[model samples]
Target chain A: MKKLINSADTILEESLDGFAAAHADILLLGAERKFVRRRTLKPGKVALISGGGSGHEPLHAGFVGLGMLDAACPGQVFTSPTPDQMIEAAEAVDTGAGVLFIVKNYEGDVMNFTMAAEMAGREVASVVTNDDVAVEKSTYTTGRRGVAGTLIVEKMVGAAAETGLPLAALTALGEEVNRRTRSMGVALLPCTVPAAGRPNFALADNEMEMGVGIHGEPGRRRVPLASADAIAAELLDAILKDLAPGKGSEVLLLVNGFGATPLIELYLMVNAAKRILDSAGVAVVRFLTGSYVTSLDMAGVSITVSVLDSKSTKLWDAPVQTAALRWGV
Target chain B: MKKLINSADTILEESLDGFAAAHADILLLGAERKFVRRRTLKPGKVALISGGGSGHEPLHAGFVGLGMLDAACPGQVFTSPTPDQMIEAAEAVDTGAGVLFIVKNYEGDVMNFTMAAEMAGREVASVVTNDDVAVEKSTYTTGRRGVAGTLIVEKMVGAAAETGLPLAALTALGEEVNRRTRSMGVALLPCTVPAAGRPNFALADNEMEMGVGIHGEPGRRRVPLASADAIAAELLDAILKDLAPGKGSEVLLLVNGFGATPLIELYLMVNAAKRILDSAGVAVVRFLTGSYVTSLDMAGVSITVSVLDSKSTKLWDAPVQTAALRWGV
Candidate 1:
């Protein structure tokens, strides 16, 4: 792969080094360098930690700061971080309030975080998010895979944690956010892993993969490339069918890019998505358009909808001061 | 040609609609839908206005908000906006403190903005940024093309404007900021202009275009793809040659992606860029890494270095709450 990396073996450490150097004021790299925690910890506030593979940047690390994640333990590209890494991050960020692990519903991530919590032996609680409506079983997981909706869970849980929510309440809040969120993605170009040196999957010039996973895992199926409006309709139909929100339900829409997609295309897709939602009598009160969760270099986009009520809307609108998502204080 | 756009002819208007819909709280679309302004104007504050071609998003329009541009005029894709659009934006944002136009040094942009400034009967000043160190003349300009450094200019000028700097003082500050910055870019894949229905240029599988412009303009001739460190060194070497900063110069570095590039690669380039700057006896006080000024879906990056002093550094660190770039606000 023609990536701007020194070596595949050093990609994780070097990238972490870059992150540490660029945002030293907001993130502190642990001695092991596999984990990152807030530069300063706030006492009596519940600490939020989330992480997974490394390729999906700004996912865990970029979300670490005030009003969001307190710590993040990033694994190698597409690999799970070891239990030791997670434990270190947990120990570093945990104050008197407690620690919450926001885990995506992936086999490796769930297993590793569970081990880390057990090894730490602290008042740790976890919430697993499985919001992808694409497939029941994917290449790496038995059930549905976690996707962009993980960002919503983190935002809501982080805001609630800021309010000094106890461990059980915080966990329940995260679970509720997950239950209210659904996501679906399509890929126009496959991403190349630095180590693999080739695209993970292959498609013809005029073919596109619908409901594709973040890791290039198999999705519903390949389909002929279609116009933006048609593609938006299909993705939105799948997501709305899975969500089944009531008429005139308020929701937060996220048009997330999978790495190689441009903002122009993302914005266009957002336009199409808004049209679809408008026709369905859904009121998208809040929205974000960017590459929050991304595959390494895949040219694609994912649509995420978080059905929100009064309480959930308040939490989602709460202040967040992370590298990726920031608003209000 | 596989883009998430309904059609080439409608892409610009539809994307602007998406931007307005997604960020209604921060932006207000004008009657003609050719420009964007802040939702609420700050009376007596010097207003900053910028305009250019439409493809480089989050540049002019996304930067319109508190502590940034008061308004932005967007032209057709890769084509400069007409004088009427700029005049409307200028008139709308021109408070008693007057308006400052930040123009990129492209032929059409400079000409149209100059005409608009002349048409504007009130106090108006303009600063044309020409910071590209790649070429003296390119496909669209007679001199160095404006690149990502324009963002730095807007940011510094915007902060100064918040202090109620007069139109003359704001113009001088912008010009000084432009004078101290230099940038160079590279492209791995050419972007497909919506109207063109194809990529503007071509590259071989193992080849890369160094110093490519934001409009797919040719740069210092292409060479075989090399190591990331080597490429970083070469780009930095060219930029430093153009800047000629003395030893111990404190600079703000920006590793900007040309759309369609992954954050992983951008971060890695930042890592590489830092090493080169550090070794060159330069101290990087601050930096930003992401897609700032992009060319549709071109897969590449541009590195910008602005030699900073105490005054400029203070302005650079000021709060900005735009959609694309925001911190400390």
Candidate 2:
């Protein structure tokens, strides 16, 4: 695969070690390296924890800090973490206010987190995210896969949780945010898991996989490569059809890179998406363009649309301090 | 060739439009779209202006905002910006405090920026960055090629300029920062320019280009692909040799990705680089890791080490609010 790693077996541990060292100011490695938690806990505040496979970096771990995730459990590449990791994370970061688990709709992840919550001795609740409108069922997920829209859920709910919301309230907020969001991705090139030593899938030079999942799962269809405008139109059409925000509704538009897409192309896609939204009479109240939630080295882009209410908009603008997303801190 | 762009002809303008729309709060597009300037200008703060080829996505434009460049002019991909762009940028951003041009050491960039300063009709100074220690002279540069270390220069000098330093002092500070910084890059795959529609260069599947330039310029040599630790050691060896920072010296270590590399690999590189630094008795006081300075969609990385003194360290820690780098704003 020609990846920049020492050995496939050590990728997770070495990457975790590097992440912990680089962000030591804001993150702490939990016992057994099962999870990453905030260095300082806000007493009496609801603790928000999320995790999934490790390939999608800056998703769970990079979101841990002041106004985002309280802790994150990372498993091996595209593999779910054990229940012990989640339990230990809850034990470490959950103050007396209780804990909220933001779990994506992967079968392995859902089962492990559910087990963790059941076994953990604390007041815990879970918000399962299935915001990807790409497919109703995928290889790893029973329902629509949780894609880039998970970031919006974490962000809005994290801000609310930082206001000392009760665990039940935070869980409700997270679920509501997830309901308001939809995402779809298109892959230009497949990514290789370090251990796999080969790309998950191959594509002809002029072909693309549309509505692809974060783990490189089969999407809605494969088709001829198209222009940026056409691609944006297709992804946005799917998301808007599912989201169904009325005319003049305000929304947050996120053009997320699937690892290998450069910022310039992402911004270009943002422009294309904004044009589509403007014609659709959807007001883009806020815009975020970057590679926040990424598959390892997949060359693609995911478009996320989240309908924003007054409260959600305010929370989106609230200060956040994390390794990946930071502003007004 | 499978980039998410409409057309090679429209890539620059469309991307600029999206960047302006996305970061409307922090940036403004100049007339004729020659430059991007800060939305809210500090009337008396020394203006920091930088520009170069357009493919380096976030280097010049993304760094424009609070505590950074006042304006950035983007040229066509892999081409130097015209002198008129720089002159217009200076005219738009320069207050009574004068402007400082931070030019990378490339034939066209240095020549054009020099011409702009002379014709700018305002108090002006320049800091030419040549931080790449890979070659004494290369294809586009007479001395060292400016690479990722330009970000460090902009950051440290940006903080000093925010403190109301005059153009001369900021120029001197920038020069000092440049002197203390050294960088080297390695490429696993060559990136394609959208216009070219083909990879810039080719490497055997098992080979890599070490000490490569940001623009795919020839480097030290091509060798069999090595493990991350061995690559990190080689890059650091060259940088530490050039920097000659004595034992116990504090440094800011930056592991920058070349566009297509993922965050996981970058952080793993951070870990590898840190181990080498630790063993060398050099303390990393600050760590900045990401795809800040990039070569279109190249899959590679560059390692930069900047020796830090008390003042420079504080300046590095100071607030910076840009699209790519943000903290403590």
Candidate 3:
């Protein structure tokens, strides 16, 4: 693969180094580079920590800042971080208020974070996210895999946590946010893991994998490449079917890119998705469109809808100072 | 080509509709969808207006909001907007303080913006950006073609305009920022325009175009695919040579992706660029990395270094609430 990296073996560390350097004001690298924690900690506030494989950038680490993740443990590309890494990150970022581990519903990640919480000498809780309605079981996950909606979970729960909520309360809020969110993705092109030096999968020029996972795992089905409106209809139909929002329910719509999709296309998808939602009688109170959660260089898009209550809507609008998602203050 | 678009004819309008819907709080769509202007304009503040091809998103349009461009016109993909679009944008956004046109140095863009300025009834000034050091003359430009450094010009000058600088002063500031900035890009893969339905250019699996333009134009030369470090050195060598900042000069280093390049690769490139800057005794006082300026879905990156003086540095740090670039606001 003609990737812009020195070597697959050193890609993660080198990228982490660069990330730490570039966002030094917002984050600090933990010892041995096991994790990245916010540079300034809010004492007595619940510390929210999250992490997963490294390929999905601006996910866990980019969310670390004033109103989001307190710390993030990044593993090698598509590999889970060790329990020791999570424990150390908890030790560093957890104030006396305790810690909340926001784990995606992946086998390796869940197991490791569970182990970390068990071994860590603190009041710790975990919220496992499984918002991807794309699959009940996948190559790396059981049940629905956590996808772009994980960002919504972190954002909403992170805002609530910043209000000095207890760990238990924050965990509940995170779980609630995840429950209200659903996501589905489609892949137009496969991504290459530098280590593998080949695409994770192959597709004919006129084909697309619908409901694909963030790690390039097989989705519901491969279909002929379709126009944006048709693709949006399929993805949003599945999401709305699972969500089953009331006729006038207000929601937040997120159009996330799977790395290679440009903003132009993502916005176009957003327009198509909005049209579909309008016809479905769902009111989109907020909209987010970008490549916040990405899979290497996969060319695709994911639609995330989170049913918003007054509290959740307020939290979603709350000021966030993360590297990837920022607004008011 | 596999793309998330309905049709080439509808792509621009659909994306614009989505953008206008998503960022309604920050901007408003002009009549006939000619341009996007700030939702809340400062009555007496100098207005900044910019426009170019639509493919390089978040450039002209995304930069419209508080502390940036007051209005932005988006042309068809890789094509310049008509002079009528620019004139209407100037009419819509110009306040008593006048309007400043930040035009990229392309044949069509420069010519159209010039015609707009001449026809504009209100006071008007222009700052033409030509920061690319790749070629003296290329397919669409005379002198060095403007590239990613145009973003830096808009940012720094946008901040100055927000402070109520006169159109003339803002124009001078923009030109000064342009003079201090230099950029170079490299493309690993060519992107396809929806209308073309084929890659803009071709390269062997082991080939890359160094010093490439944002539109996938031929660059300095085609070379064998090389490691990030080697590529970063060659790009920085040309940029630093052209800029020739004094030792210990502080600079804002921007590592911009050409759409399809992942954040991991971009940050790794930032690390590589930083190391070179350190060796050259230039301190990077600021860092902005992302796919701010992009070709459709080209897999590559561009590095921009803007030598910062005290005034320009302060302006760069000033609050900017644009959709794409936001910090300290």
Candidate 4:
């Protein structure tokens, strides 16, 4: 793989080191190198933590700061972080209010975070997000594979946590956010894992992997490449079908790129998505378009629609200051 | 080319439509669809206007909002925007303080912006940025090519403009920013224009282009791909050679991805850059890493180092909320 990395074995360590240095003002290395926590913790505020495999950057680690994740435990690429990493992160960031771990719905992630919560003697709560409607079963997951909707959950839950919600309330809020969100993704190119040194899957130039998972897991089916509008219609239809928003209902839209897609294309996809939503009589109250969640150099786009109530809208619009997403701070 | 574009002919217009729709709160389509301006302008604030060929997503357009450009005129893919578009944008954004046009140092850009300023029929000042130290001449220019350093100019001058700097002062400030900055880039892969449906340049599987321009122009030389550390060292060394930063001098370092490179690689590069700068006895007072400026889908990075005094540092730290870059607000 033509990647700008050191030795493949050192990729994780070096990347973490760089991430720590780049965001030193808001984050610091946790007790263990595999985790990162906020530089300062509020004594009575609920601490929010989320993590998964390392490839989906700006997800867990990049969100570590004020108004977002208090701590993040990143695993090696596509591998789950050990329970010890999660425990250390939780212990380090848990204020008297308690700690909440937002785990994506993957078997390894769910199990390890559960173990970490059990190991942590302090008050700990966990919320598992399974908002990806693309697949009910995948290589690394059972039921639904959590995908881009995790970003929405993190933002809303982080905002709610910042309001001094207790652990139980915060966990319930996270689960509610997950319940109201749905996501679907399409991949034009499979990403190469540095360790593997090749693409995880191969496809002809004219074909695309629809409903592909973040780690190149199986999706609905392979299909011939279509126009951006068609792809947008398909992904948006899938998400709205799963969401089933009532007419004139307001929704927050997220059109995310899978790493390699450029902003222009994301904007194009956003246009298509907006048109589709308009035709469906849904009002896009707020929209975010970019690579908020990403695969490792994968060329694809994902559409996520979250049905929003007034409280959810307030939480979503709340100020956030993080490495990747920031505004109104 | 494998891109998520519907058609080359409509890509620019559609992308602009999406941008306008997505950022409606902060931006509005100008008299002509070719230009976009901030939704509201501060009365008597010196307006900053910038534009260039399309494909450099989030450069000029995404920088428009709050304490940045008042208007942006996007051209066709890899083509200079017309004088008429600039005239319309300038007329719409100019309030009595006059407008400062920030043009990149390309023949077409310079000539067109010049015509637009003359036709503006208002007090107008223009500054052309040519901070790329890669080559004195390239496929599109007689002098140095303007690359990522334009971002530094816009941000600092934008802050200065918000402080009510007059047309002449903002123009001079932009010129000063261009003077203090130097940049060099390396491309691992060439980008393809959607219309062309092929790569702009060719490279062997194991080779990379050093000192490459944003538009895939000829660089200093091509070399076999090296490790991330080696690549970082090479790029930083060239920029420092051109800059010749004094010992203990404070600098703002920008490690910009050329669109397709992921954050992980850019962070890896930041680590390498910081180490090199620390060893060189130069203090990095501030730094920004991400794809602030980009070629459509090129896999590459550019390093910009700008010597900063106290005033420049304050300007850089000032709050500016735009779609692409935001902090300290």
The two-chain DockQ for each candidate, comma-separated, is 0.70, 0.85, 0.82, 0.72
Q: Which 10 successive residues of model 1 chain B have the least lDDT summed? A: B320-329
Give residue A278's lDDT in candidate 4 (0 to 100).
96
**What level of docking quality does candidate 3 show?**
high
- Once superposed on the true structure, which residue ranges of model 1 sit more than 4 Å away at CA? none
For every model shown, what is its TM-score relative to the native structure?
Answer: 0.98, 0.99, 0.99, 0.99
Q: In candidate 3, how many Å is residue A245 off? A: 0.6
Error of 4 at B128 (Å): 0.8
* A103: Cα error in model 4, Å: 0.7
Best by DockQ: 2
Cα lDDT tens digits for candidate 3, A187-227: 99999999899999999989999989999999999999999
Q: CA lDDT of each candidate?
A: 0.90, 0.93, 0.92, 0.89
Checking candidate 1 for backbone clashes, the offending pairs are none
* Highest lDDT scorer: 2
Interface RMSD of each: 1.2, 0.7, 0.8, 1.1
Q: What is the lDDT of residue B227 in candidate 3?
A: 97
Clash number for every model? 0, 0, 0, 1
Give the better candidate number (2 or 3) by lDDT.
2
Off by over 4 Å in 4: none
Mind giving the per-residue lDDT tens digits that candidate 4 earns over B237-291?
A: 8888888989999999898988888888888888888889999998887879888
lDDT of 1 by residue, A169-196 (tens): 9999999999999999999999999999
Q: Please give, for every candidate in the order listed, the TM-score of chain B alone compared with the true chain B.
A: 0.98, 0.99, 0.99, 0.98
lDDT of 2: 0.93
